[model samples]
Every structure is written in structure tokens, then in C-alpha cells.
Target: MPAGVTTEGCPDSIHQMEVERDDTHSLKRSMSTMQLTMIGVGGTVGTGIFFILSEAVPEAGPGVLVSFLIAAAVAGLTVLCYAELASTIPSSGSSYSYTYATMGELAAFAVGACLILEYGVSAAAVAVGWSEYLNLLLNNLFGIQFPDALSAAPDAGGIINLPAVILVVLCMLLLLRGASESARANAIMVFIKIGVLGVFAAIALTGFNADHFANFAPEGMHGISIAAGSLFFSFIGLDAVATTGDEVKDPKKTIPRALILALGIVTLVYVVVAFAALGAQSAEDFEGQKASLATIVQGVVGSTWPGTLLAVGAVISIFSVTLICMYGQTRILYSMGRDGLVPPVFAKVSPKRSIPLVNTFIVSGAVAILAGLLPLGILADLTSIGTLSAFALVSIGVMVLRRTAPDMHRGFRVPGYPVTPILSVAACIYVISGLHALTLQAFVGWISVALVFYFLWSRKHSELARLQAQAENLTGDQV
Candidate 1:
């Protein structure tokens, strides 16, 4: 029989899964808990808090605060499931790997496609947000701005979003250098983001008016739920910690700690910032505002300097979010490549640099094009739906794994076990149902394409499937 196969069949055991990781070309384990935690924070905190208020507040009024909490709760439950799976089967593919070990190849492929939409398209959406802030910073500080033809997407009345494209390229270059360098840069950016948010909160709170709370839930529960669906986009990066399992030191302990720590920090910052922003201005003002946080600060302080500071901070910090999102996308592709689900070039790591250089280039190029050509609103809705679907699958995978491999050594276990995972799935489904009808249609279309590719191409070339076939053939010969 082939290695990792049993007399009965190809079992989804840890040993069998280990056979998939090629030891000679594996990711370098240089990241610490702090770096991993920072990656999670860096990936998540910027675009959602910095720019999403403009989109979410209009949907829920002042009650967008409840939307933030709802989104965070769903994210928190999924994070618990992620922690358990990452501890039990530490790998680079995040939910894709978890699904594979617990479910099967087809399910893993579907989850991988969802991850592509979540990370790749999300990076594009974030880059667009960064562009908004960059333009604001430039106009405030230098009295100059890119022409709408160069700075906005075609759908948004521009030929292309050049700054967003440029930002993606810069991140790709940094990623090409190595993970350590990328993590260090991300750590610094995360601190800057947190500090800038703090300053905005402090300044904005000074102008808080109790009148803003008079009609808080003006749109009712339906509006709040829809806003929560949009706000869920903000929480997309928490699972990024799980993606670094293969690269972080002592992943079992490191991943769970990073996931929880990152979630706590993000949820607190989001709520505080939401409170400060909403208190400073009426919910109606958030609609169609670019660089909304900075605008809020400007209104509250009645000065250009404070808003300029916020814009500058946004431009810097949102870059970190794009970088980490792109990083996550490339790593997921690398994992898929190793499984023969995509082209082999994606799995090729640079021996000297200890990074997937080609993979980074491919992912960055695609993300840059999307950022430059597509409008941010569509990109964000697509990202939110894809992320929620992937989260739901991961939560289900946790329950499946517990039954299939109950003896697996998990360094961290979900405190509530079955209940927690069940809630995680339900929460994801609830939020997903609140998304726009068009978003749901687009997601279904994307998943259908993925399934087609899996059946026609991936199923034939899949490494795990090939191994199973070999084992079965050998067993038949012996009989």
C-alpha cells in the first residue's frame, strides 16, 4: 500500500494529510506570536473601520453600532472554530486545509475558491479605500489631487484607480522580499493604525451630541441586519492568523492566542470608533462620504490639520491591510498548487528568499487589475458573501472533524464544543442572508464556475485523489 493509506481506504488522518506537505520546500517557521497577532490585526483593522462606516451607517442609521457588534459576534464564534482546527491541524491553507482533512477534496476545492474571493477581491476593495484616503491626504497636505480619470475606477467616473494599482505593486515587492520583513513592516503599521484610531476617537468624542442617539434605530432590525452583513466585510482578516500556521513558531499555541487576541483588539477598536464617529455627526452624514473618519474629525474639531492627520494615518495603515490580504491570497494559492488544483507554479517557493515569488506576482497582478478597474462597492459586497460562506464551512468542518478524528491532539479546543460550532454556522448563515440579492447571485455564479473547474480539471490532477487510486490498485493486486 502507498504511504499514509490503510487497509480499509485512504483515511483523513493527520498522518495522511502530512503527506501533502513537501518538507524540502516548506514555509519557513520564523514568525512569533506577536508577529502573527499583528498580521491578523494589520489585515483586518484598516479598511473596515476607516472607510466602511460610509457604507454601513446609511443602511442602519446610528444603530450601525449594533451592526458592528453583530458582525463581531459572528466573527468571534468562527474564530473559536478556527483556533481549534489550526491547533489540531496546523497548515498554511487556513479553512481549505481544515475542510480537506475533515471533509473531502471537492469540499476543500470549494472552500479554496471562496478564500480566493475573500482575500484576493478583498485586497482589491481595500486598495480602493486606501486610494480614497491617499487622495484626501494629498489634497489636504499638498493642495494636489490625482485627476478623476486616473484615481477613480471607470464605473466611478474614472479611467482607472492608479493609486490603488500602485499600492498593490508595492505590497507585492515587499512580499517578495520575505515573510519576516513583511511581518515587521505590518507590526509597525498596526501600531500606527491603532494610535490613529485612538486619536480620532479622542477628538471626535469632544464634539459628541446626545441628539444623535434620539433616533438611533430609525431603520429598525431589518436595516441593522443588512448593515451587519455589510459590516461583516470588516472582520475578514481574523482568519489570516490561521493561514500563518505553517510559518509561525509553535503554531498550535501561537495560532489560537493570535486569533483571540486579534479579535478582542479589533472588536474593541471598532465599537469605540463607531461610537465616537456616530456621536460626532448624525447618521445621515455618513452616506456617500469619502474618508468618513477624517471628515468626522474635521467636523468635530473645525480644523484642517486634524482631518489631514487622520487621512495620512488612513493612507499608511490601509496599505498594511492590502499587503496582508494579498499575502493571505498567495499563500492559499500556494497550498492549492501543491494539491495540483491549480498550476504548479503557484507552489514554487524561492529557495533564497523563502517566499512564493511567482505566486505573489500572479496574485498581485490580478488584485491590482481588479482594484484599478472595479468599483469598491461591488468588490466589498462580493468579499463579504465569500467570507461568510467560507466561515460557515469552517465551522461545519470543526464538527465533522471532532466526529471523524476525536483523538486528534488539539492544543486549543472550543470551550462550548458542539454548541459553539453550531452557533458559528448559524451566525454565518444569518449574516449571509442579509446581503444584497445581487451579491448572492454573483456568489452563486462564482461558485458554479469553481465547481465546473473542479470537475473538469482539478479532480483529475488532485494529488490526494491520485494517491487514493494508487493505494486501492495495490490492495486489489494483493487480493
Candidate 2:
């Protein structure tokens, strides 16, 4: 029998059964490497770059540039491991699917719970970010902004973020239409985001000052490490490329190519944008700016028009991020549902649209609630913790799969094998350690709830258990 194949009944064989059942309901494989790369760019280049500098720069000063590079290296290493796993198991669940096939149900469930933060909460974070940019755009264009009472989250002294809720609803509607449509929209948004950022960098660089670099390392090495940890959140969406392995035209080749392509593109953009911003203004100026890029542009251009343009781009780009992140969350849950780890309604695809309609709606609703009620700072930190945990698992899973199933066909293998995986894991741990204690506690609590659900509900209702029972009955009949 093949490595993934089982003789009569085994827990691991459930994936094969699920794959077989998915013939009729599988996602459409219409996306190419270009679209996949764009999706990665779209998913990653959201609020982290747009809003993170205000927080990170205050910690690392101008040396935050190095932090961006360090974070990119960590992201790059993880992307390599992800490419290998994605090719090995061309499923839509991303790390959750990879872990389920290689690890077990409980592990996958825990990872899925963390992924809720990575994708779902990140979507909420991005939506809130979109709302801020929308407010900036409105203020710049018409000299009017949403009253803080309606525009801000309760924690931020507002009742609810109506614009964020509206953005989530809009993305949800776009996603319900279909994957191909969403991918196309994402690609378009990616271009707009890059173009606008390019414009900002160009304009900002023209006013570059040597004075900003004078106090570069004032915060020392510790600050740089802290900034890198925060910047890690910016690189969260690279795995979005791997998650669409099932939706790509050529899983093996396309997934790996797209992963690297996306990583390189995103890293370059981040470095360039960071350099330009630092050069245009002193690091201290970014301390409390809500919309850092817009502020940078406005100062450089000496006008509100350019700032408005950047805000418009951010609004569009972050909307795509929310769309892709929400799409990822639903698919992960859909896979969990198929494995009987969650309710079946989550796995059911809409016949007309061929998308997980119910799951998407559930994710959108949850995301809207989070976006409407929570502040961006906490949401971003929580997203970082979830992403770091899930990414660490992917690194470990690569080494485990390589050792256990050395013969498995891998489309892209990590370059240094054990060393690369070791570094990836270590890097993830280092970054995770820098996360706020509260974020860690919240993550622990969240995972405990998921595990409790697994033991009390999922274990009994698991499809794997049913297969084992059927196999036992067959053996008894033979006896």
C-alpha cells in the first residue's frame, strides 16, 4: 500500500476518504501561479505595513529597518517549509490540513483554533485598518470624518466601527460569489497597493534626510528584537499562497513558485517602503501617527491630495486582505468539518457557487463582531501570536514528514533540511516569546476551549472512529 493509504481502517486513511468524497464538491482549480502570488501579496501587505510602523518605530527607532529584514528572513524560511507541505498535501486547510495528515485530529484542531486568530482575527484587524484609512480618505477629501462615536471601537471611545462592519460585509459578499472572482479582485488590488506604495516611496525619498539616521540605534538591540516580533505580523499572509494549493492549476510547481515569488516581492516592498518612510521623516514622528503612510506622504507632498490617494489605496488593499483572510478561515473550518472535528454544516459547499457559503458567513460574522468592538492594537498582537504558533507547527511538520515519509513526493524541499527547519522553529519561538503576556494567555485559553470541545464532542463523532468501527466489524464477520 502507499504511504498515505491504509489497509482496512486506520485514522490516517480518513484523509483519502475525504479526498475521494471531495471529487464533486472540491474548489475550482483555476488560479495560476501569478494569481497565487498576487493572493499572497494581497493577503500580506495589509494593515501591518500600513499601521504597524507607528508602534514598531517607537520601539526600534530608525533601526526598525533591520527588524523588517529579520522578520522577512523568518517569514522566508517558513514559506520554504510551507511550500513542501502544501505540495505534499494539496489541500485547502493550509497548516491545519498538513498537521491533520501528519499529526492527528487533536493537533489539527488546536492549530485550527490558532488559525482562527491568524486568518479570522487578522481579517477583523484589517477591516478595522480599512476603516481608519477610509476615515483618513474622507477627512482629506471632504474635510469630514465619521464621528468617533460611530467610527471607533468601544475600547477606542466609540460605540462601534460601522465602516469596518460594512467592509466585512462587502468582502463576504464578494467571496460568496466565487474564488476565481475573488482572486481576480485580489490581483487588481495588489497592483493598486503596490502602485500607491511605489508613489509614496518615490515622493518620500525625494525629501530624504540624513538626520533621521543619526539616532538610528538609540533603542539598542533589544528594541530591534521587539520590533521584529511586531513586524512578524506583517508577513502573516505568505501562507495564504500555500492554502490555495488545491485551487492552483499545478499544485507542486505552482505552489512553490508562488510562495517564493510572493515572499521576495513582499520583502522587497516592505524594505523599500520602510527605508523611504524613515528617510522622509525622523523616526520619532511615527510615534503616534494613526495612518503612518498617509502622514508621511502628506508631509512630503505638502498637500492632502496625495495623502487621500494613499488612503484610497489602503482602503482597497486592506479590503482584499480581509477578503482573503476570511476566505482562508472558512476553508480551514470547512476541512475541520469534513473530518467531523466540527459540525457538518461548515463543510457543506454551496452547490450554486461552489464555495463554503455557511462557513464563510460564520467567519464574516465573527470577524465583523471583532472588528466592530475591539481596538486594533490588541487585535494585531493576537494575530501575531496565532500566526507565529501556526507557522512554528508548519516548520516542525516539515521535519516530521521528511523523517517519517522520506519517499513522499515533495514538490519543493527545504534547502538545508534539518538546519533550516531548526532555524525556522527557533525563530518562531523567539518571536512568540516577545508577544505580550496577555496575548499568550488569551491564546492558551482559546486553545483550551478548542481541545475541550474536541474531547467532549469531536472525538466521539470523528469520521476516523467510524472507519475504525467499520474495519472491526469486517474482521469480526470474517472470524
Question: Using TM-score as the measure, which candidate wins?
Answer: 2
For all candidates in order, the CA lDDT equals 0.87, 0.84
- Every model's TM-score: 0.92, 0.92
Q: Which digits, one per residue and each the tens of the lDDT, describe model 1 over residues 252-361?
A: 89999999999999989999999999999998899999878888888877788887788777887889989999999998898888888988899998898888888998
> What's the residue-level lDDT of 194 in candidate 2?
94
The residue pairs found clashing in candidate 2 are none
The clash tally of candidate 2 reads 0
Residues 127-196 of candidate 2 have per-residue lDDT tens digits of: 8888888887888788888899988988778999999999999999888888888899899999998999
Q: Candidate 2, which segments miss by more than 4 Å at Cα?
A: 1-18, 154-159, 214-216, 219-221
Worst 10 residues of 2 by lDDT: 1-10
